[model samples]
Target: MFVAAALALLATMILTIVRALSGPTLYDRLLAANSFGTKIVLFIAVYGFLAGRPDFLDIALVYTLINFVGTVAVLKFYEYDDSVGGDYQEDDY
Candidate 1:
């Protein structure tokens, strides 16, 4: 059962990669990348269980946190277009 789930996750990850590569917009690609990261976490957890290695869970948790932070940072960068100098200018909309 675990093996089957792992395989399914792998397939879904592949599809996510394809979507990330061929997405029509930046947001679509970002969504796909986030999904791919989630699938990777699931895959790692499942594989760890199947292989009887409990340490993998810790690694997966850490990876999940990193992925979340990275996604947020990228979104913030795109949204504000700000830099470390704090010279943010409002868009003239």
Candidate 2:
């Protein structure tokens, strides 16, 4: 049933969180976070259906996209910093 699926995804989300926290490297943590975000989108969609709320799906979709973009941006920042051999700090001046 949908409840069972939702529970399964919830477990996966928890696992992903652990992975993100205990990851050995930056890439590993990022991968875990990305996977968590993806699982969250699935969770929200299913939850919305079970609760008879279709509008939630739209929000989930937007969140998913934003999560993906944010992850990519963070990863890029890290990668750039690594290549530059220094931590990045922006100056608004």
Candidate 3:
């Protein structure tokens, strides 16, 4: 049953990948990536549980935080890029 759940998650993950790949706009792609990141974190937790690796959950939680931060950063960067016409007008950091 655990493996069955994993397979279902994998199927949904594939759909998310397709959404990310074919997104028509930056926001759409960002959303898809964010969703994928969230799913990945869950997948890690479930798989780790099934494999009896309790410690792996700590790493998964850490990566979940990273994924959230990364998604925000990517969205902010894209917004800045769009607003500035892809020019380096703002602070260079």
Candidate with best TM-score: 1
Candidate number with the higher lDDT (1 or 3): 1
* Estimated TM-score for each candidate: 0.84, 0.82, 0.80
Give per-residue CA lDDT, model 3, range 23-43, as digits (tens). 765556778888898888888
* Better-scoring candidate (lDDT), 2 or 3: 2
Q: What TM-score number comes out for model 3?
A: 0.80
For residues 11-84, could you state the per-residue lDDT of candidate 2 as single tens digits? 99989999999987666788998999899899999998878886888889898889989998997787666664
Descending-lDDT candidate ranking: 1, 2, 3
Each model's lDDT = 0.86, 0.83, 0.79
- Please report the candidate that would top lDDT against the real structure: 1
Q: What stretches of model 1 exceed 4 Å from their correct place?
A: 82-93
Which digits, one per residue and each the tens of the lDDT, describe model 1 over residues 1-93?
Answer: 999999999999989999999987676788999999999999999999889886879899998999999999888887776453243345523
